[model samples]
Target chain A: MRVSVIATAGNIAGEALSNKSVVMFDILRASSTISTALANGCKEVIPVIDVEDAFALARQLPEGSFILGGERGAIKVTGFHLGNSPLEYTASVVKDKTVIISTTNGTKAIRYAAGENGRVFIGSLLNCSSVAKALADLSKDIVLVCAGTRGKFSLEDTLAAGLVIKDLLKFFNKNPWQAKTQEHNKFYLEETPIFNNDALILEDAAVAALRLAEYYWQSPIQGLLDSLHGQKLLQLGLAADLDYCSKLNHLTNVPVFFNDKIL
Target chain B: MRVSVIATAGNIAGEALSNKSVVMFDILRASSTISTALANGCKEVIPVIDVEDAFALARQLPEGSFILGGERGAIKVTGFHLGNSPLEYTASVVKDKTVIISTTNGTKAIRYAAGENGRVFIGSLLNCSSVAKALADLSKDIVLVCAGTRGKFSLEDTLAAGLVIKDLLKFFNKNPWQAKTQEHNKFYLEETPIFNNDALILEDAAVAALRLAEYYWQSPIQGLLDSLHGQKLLQLGLAADLDYCSKLNHLTNVPVFFNDKIL
Candidate 1:
C-alpha cells in the first residue's frame, strides 16, 4: 500500500484519485460537521458546490425532510437552516434529515475528489482512528485530500491529515501483511517487523505529514487553536466548533461520501 | 514588512503577487542559471512563456547577437543555442550576448509575477544571501514564489525559499531597522533587539519555510541532492547543475527580472 497526501483540493489533478481509496479531510468543520451529523442519526449529507446548488437540491425534497446547512466566508449562508458548526448538528435538528451543504472550501473539495472511481471517506479528528482503520482494512493505496482554505494551505486540514496518516501507519505496522522489498528498502526499515510483514510505500508528503503529527503530538488541540484558519474561526465566534473539531478519536463512525451523498 | 511564501507558482492567484516584491526561486536550475549568467557578464536574459515567444523575441533582436536557450522536458530544446544547465551559460558563450529562455516552470512564474506593480528577482542558493540583502534594502513586504516543477511542489525550490527567508530574518536581526509591533509580537520576539529595531511579519508559509530550513540546515546540499526534482535531474545526467545550485553564497549578484529582462 502506498500512502500520499495532497495539501489542498486545488493540488488534485482530475484523474489523480481514480481507483484509490481517498480520505477527505476538512477538520475546521466540514468533515467534523458531517461526521457529527451522521453520528447524530442524520440520514445523509448531499454536498453541493454553491448556495444555488444547495437551494436547488433542497427544493426537490419535501419541506422539513431536508435542511439547508453550510457557511460562506465562515458565517451561515443567508437562509441556511444551520451553519457549519458541528455542535449545531444535534439529534433534534438533523435527525432523519438530509443536509444540503455548501461551504466555501469543503464541498468544493468533495466535488473535486468525486471525479471518478474511488471511495471518498470524510475524515476529521472526531473519526480519525476509525477512518484510518477502514483504510487499512481496504488494504489499497490511499490518498488523504485536505480541503485547504481557498486555494491556499490550511494548517488545520493538514494536521488532521497528519493525524490520519500517523494512525494508518500505526495500524499497518502492528498488523502482519506481505512486504514489498523496494518500498521497504526506500524507508530503510529492513529490520522493522512491519516492513518484513507488509509492503508499504509512503510518499514524501505522507512522511512529512507523519513528522508534522509527531511535532504536534504533545498538544494537537493547541496546534489547531494556533493555526491561521483556527484563529479566523475563533474571531468569528466559532471557538466551540474549534474545540469540538480538535478532539481526537471522539467518534467511532467513518462517514463515507459516495454517489453524491455522505452515508 | 510581511513575508509570505507560495509553495508553487500554480497556487498564486492572478492578483496575489500584485504590488508585492516577488522573489522567484527555481533552485534546481532556472533561477540558478539566470543568476550565474548575469554574474558572468551576460548582457541580459529575456524570460518568455513558450518556445515560440523565445523565437519571436529573438527575431526582433540583431541576428548573431542573441542566443535562444532553455529546456522543454529537462533536455535542451531543438535548435537552441544552449540548455538550462548553468555551466552552459559560461563567460565565453553568454557574456555580452542577449539570451532568451523558456523553460518548463521558471519562466512561467516570472511571467505570473510580472502582472503588475512590484519588482521580480531571480533567486537560488548561489545568490540566496545576496537576494535577501537586496530585499532588506528594499524595506518592503516580500513574497517568495517557488517555481515548482510542473504545477506541483518541488522540494528544492521550497527549501531554497526557506533559505532566503532564513537569511532575511538574520539580516533584520543583525541590522537596526524600524520594527512593526504586530509582526514582532506574532513571532514572539518582544525581548529581542531586532524586534525593537525593525518590524517584520511572517505569513504561515514563511514560518513553515523557516522551520523547514532549520530542519535541514546541517546539510542543505544533501537535501537538494535528495529532492524529487534533483533526483530527476541527476537521472538526466545533470548532476553538475545540481552541485552548482546546491552551493550557498557562491555568487554575490542579485539578478532582478524587470521590464521583461533579467539584468
Candidate 2:
C-alpha cells in the first residue's frame, strides 16, 4: 500500500491519480456533509464546482426529488436548501432525495479526482476507520487528496487523511517497498490483490500527514479548530458544525464516487 | 508576522515570495553544504541551477580562487571538484575559496526565489536556530521554500522548516492575527516596523510542518532517516552526510544571499 498525499487538488495532474484509489477529504465540511447526507438516506450526490452548475443540475432533476445543497464562504448559498453543515443533513431533511451540491473546495476536489477514471472515496473524521478498512481491503496504491481552501493547504483535511493513514499503517505494519504489477486491473473489482512480498511505502506527504495526525491523536477537535478554515467557521458562529465535523469514526460506511454521483 | 510554507518550489508563483523573506531548505545536502562552506570561511557561494551555468560562472571568476561543487543523482558531476556531501566541505579545502555550486533542486529553488526581488537566506538543521532568530528579528512575513526532491515534498526539508516555525511560535507566543499594511516597505530595511497589536500566524502548511517536527522533537535523525530522500542518500553510502546535516544549530552563522552570492 504505497501512498502519496497531495495537499490540494489545484496542483495535481489528473493522470497521476489514474492508477491510484483516491480518498478525498474536505473535512471543514464537504466530506463530513457528504457522509452525513448519504448515511441519512440521501439517494446520491452530484458534485459540481460552480453555483450555476449546481442550479442547472438541480433544475434538471425531477421537482421535489432533489435538494440544493452546499455553501459559499461557510454560509448556505442563496436559494439552496442547506449550507455545508453536517447537522443540517439529517434524515428528515435529505431522506430519499438527490443532493446537487456545490462547495468552494470539496466538490471541486471530487470532480478532479473523478477525472482520468479514478476510483474516488470521500472520507472524513466521520468515517475515518471505515475508509481505511475499505482501502486496506482494496489493496492498491493510494493518493489522499485534501481539498484545500482556495488552493492553500487546510489543516482539517490533512488531519482526516492522517487518521486514515494511521489506520493503514497499523494494518500494514512490518510491510516494507515493491510496486504491485497488473496493479490497476485487479485493484477495484471483485478480485483481491495478493502479494508474495509487499511493501507499505509512504511518500513524504503521506508520512507528514501521519505524523501530524498522530500528534493530535487524542484530540481531533483541537486539530480542526486549529485549521484556518475551521477558525473562520468558528468565528462565523458555526461551532456546532465544527463539533459535528470532528467526530471520529462516527460512520462505518465509506462513500465512493461512481458515474458522476457519490453513493 | 505571518508565515507560509511552500512544500516545494515547484508549484509556487515567484511573485508570492515577493514582499517577504525566503528561507530555502534542501536538507539532503545542498543547504547543509552551503551553510557548512560559509561557516568554514568560504568567501561566498554562488548558486546556479545548471552545470553549464556553474561552469560559466566559474569561467567568469579567477582560477584557483573558486571551486565547482554540486551533484547529479547524488554523485559528483563529471570533472566536478566534489559531490553534494557536507562532510567533504572542510575548512582546509573550502576556506577563503569561492564555490560556484550547482545542485539539482537547491540552486533551482534559489533561482526561483531570487526572481521576484525577494530577500533570500539558506537554512538547514545545522543553522536552524539562527535562521529562526533572524526571521523573528526581521519581523516580516516569511515564505519557507523547501527544495524538495525533484519537486516532490521531502520530509527532511519540512522537518527543518518545522524546527524554524516552532521557534517562531515560541518567540511570538500569544500573539494573534493581523496583516501588516505598507508591509513590503517596512520589511528588509534598517527601519524597524512597530506593531501595536500583531499576529503571529502560521498558515496550514506551516502548522503541519510544526506538528510533524514536534512529533520528532527528540529524534531528528530518525525523522531524516525516515524521509525518502534520506533513505536514498543512506543507500548511496552517505550516512556521514546525513549525520552532518541532522546536527541542530551546529553553526550559528545564517548565510544570507546577497547579489547572487551567499555569504
DockQ of 2: 0.28
RMSD (Å) per prediction: 6.5, 8.8
Per-residue lDDT, model 2, residue B64, is 90
lDDT of model 1 at residue A209?
Answer: 58
**Could you tell me the fnat of model 1?**
0.02
Predicted candidate 1 versus true structure: per-residue lDDT over A24-81, tens digit per residue: 8989889999999999999999999879978988889999999899998899999999
Q: What TM-score results for chain B when candidate 2 is compared with the true chain B?
A: 0.89
Those runs of model 2 whose alpha carbons end farther than 4 Å from true positions after fitting are A174-197, B174-197
lDDT of 1 at B99: 85
Give the per-residue lDDT digits (tens) of candidate 2, residues B1-263: 78889888787786787778789898889999999999888999988888988898888888899889999989999978988898878899999999989888898888776657745889899998899999988888989988888878888899999998877766766322222222222121222222212567778888788877776656577667668887777667677777778888899999888688898
Residue-level lDDT of model 2, residues A214-236, one tens digit each, is 76767687676567787677668
